[model samples]
Target: MKALTMARLLIRLFGVVALMTLNSVAARAEIAIAVAGPMTGQNIFRGEQIQQGAQLAVADLNAKGGVLGQRVQLLVGDDACDPEQAVAVARKLATDGVVFVAGHVCSHSSIPASKVYEEEGILMISPASTNPKLTDEGGANVFRVCGRDDQQGLVAGNYLADVWADKSIAILHDNSVYGKGLADETRKQLHKRGVKEAMYASYMPGKSDYAELVSGMRAVAIDVMYFGGYGADAGLILREANNQDFEVQLVGGDSLTTEEFWMVAGPAGEGTLMTFGADPRMNPEAAEVVDQFRAQNFEPGGYTLHTYAAVQAWTQAAEIAGSLDLMAVIKALRTHRFHTVLGEISFDQNGDVTAPGYVWYRWTKGEYVPAK
Candidate 1:
């Protein structure tokens, strides 16, 4: 009888061990994270940046043994910078079980997609969207690595008023949330500085011809133009103005920092000025990664490093929180300062990065550099 009892006890112990092993295997399966942006369309370059940055981050993290002992997997969503498509992408990612998302580059897309993410309990960290309403009206799960339009607008407006006060200035927007919001903020600051815009207009984006708009600017003899739009539209406007033989200087927001601007404007992009955070590729901490990017023949320009920093911040927060639980990670993000390629980054209550304010950059020789 004693021998039989001992045999049963051993069998029970073996069964318990087998159950625990299965659980451990299930836990180590995979952890999904997503990166979304305009992977197709006119803005595909920015999407490529987002993909490459996030891809590198995932590879590096997995090499070091991914978060919480599970291998990290990346899901790429192409919103194409469209608001409806962004919503669809967000839903798909949420359904795919991604705990975090770093994406939706356009402000219009980011704003709408944020609602879906919030409802699905997924954390979203936008690497490029800069409109203030993104944070102001966003839920706790939403965050951004880039500075707001208002902040950048203040810089642009002040710079214009201080340096081009004597020149006839015009403000133009693409009628999107990002473009209009930036233009309005710049206009506010310009008026506060006692500078009146000679023309304030909205132009439809994605059109090939802006000749009518160029004609209007020419008629007003506008010497300085502040465009609150993307590089594509801005480049077209510059090309059209130049084709009309109009000598107007163009200043814009961070969206103009891409090579697409030069590709579209050619010689017209020369001397174009814009505002963006100090380039992360120039950061000492980022030298190794930048070298890796260069070795791959990819220039980590525009929002590339920003997306990488977003992933870095998210992983650090998860490590600090000790779990991927949404609330725990959110608390960790709010309380801890993350050391990123962009330098030390901390978040405010509204989920905006507290480091690296906007600065001036100029397009010259087919690339943008710190403006002289």
Candidate 2:
């Protein structure tokens, strides 16, 4: 009787062991995290940066056993920075069963994509969308890892107005949502600071020749120019202004900090000032990860650090939620303070990062050096 009992006990123990092993294997199975951005067209570079950063975060998270003990797989969607394309990508990502999404780098793209994610109950965290209206909608699932356009523009406008009070400043925009929005905000702030004699112009995008635009500023004897546009337009405008010997100070937002801006503008890029979300190499907490990204041949850019931080926040929120359910993750993200490579990540009621800040930088000698 004793021998028979021992045999039965051993069989039960073996069965339990086998079941546990299978469950562990299942736990290690691959899971998906979608990254949506402008993977093609003019803004593709920014999208690629966002993708690389999110990939870096996934690689690092997997190395540390990943979220929920499962490996993360990235699903890349190309929104082309178009509103309609963004909605399409968001719907596809939601239908494909991706637990989380980080991208739609452009604000215009993010605005429409957000609705899809919201309706699908997918957690969408934007690393580069800075439009105030994005998070102002009070969508529980919507979160931005960067500062708003209003904050960035206000900072730039105030700085210029206070430091260069006597200079004649001109404001130009590409007439796009982001460009016009930022330009109008900056103009408001500049006006409040008693800065006048400012020329505000909206240029039709895709126009390679900005000779007349630069000449118009010259005609007004403008000394400082604040441009709210992308690198392509800014580069051309700068090159044209330089060619025509406009001889003035030029400043812009994060869009002008790209390498393409320097490549296109060449010597015209000198003295160009801009703003960036955060620099991973300069962030003490992210220095090691920055090295790892560089080792992986990924050059970090403006959205790179923010995207990586967004992934970290998502993973932390998932752990806090104790489940992969989208609503649970969104609730956790709202209530929790996630420690990320970009430092502590927390959001306010408006879905914006708490105390989010932008760094002022200048292009000096073909490099974006932090402004003193």
Q: Which has the greatest lDDT?
A: 1
lDDT tens digits, residue span 1-372, model 2: 999999999999999999999987774487788889988888777887898888888888999998887888888999999899999998899887787899878788898888888888888899888888899973788998888889988898798888788988889988877888888888888888888746888898767798899899989999988898888788888899889878888888988767778888899888898977666567788888888888887768667888899999999999998888888887887788988877887987678898557778889887898888
Give the lowest summed-lDDT range of ten residues in model 1.
23-32
Model 2 has how many clashing residue pairs? 0
Deviation of model 1 at 232, angstroms: 1.0
- How far is 82's C-alpha from truth in model 1 (Å)? 0.8
Q: Give per-residue CA lDDT, model 1, range 1-372, as digits (tens).
A: 999999999999999999999987875588999999999998888899899999998998999999877789999999999999999999999989999999889999999999999999999999999999998999999999989999998998899999999899999999999899999999999999999999999999999999999999999899999999899999999999888999999999989988888999999999999999999998998998899899999999999999999999999999999999999999999999998989998999999999878999999989999998
Question: Which residue pairs come into collision in candidate 2?
Answer: none
Which portions of model 2 miss their true places by more than 4 Å?
1-29
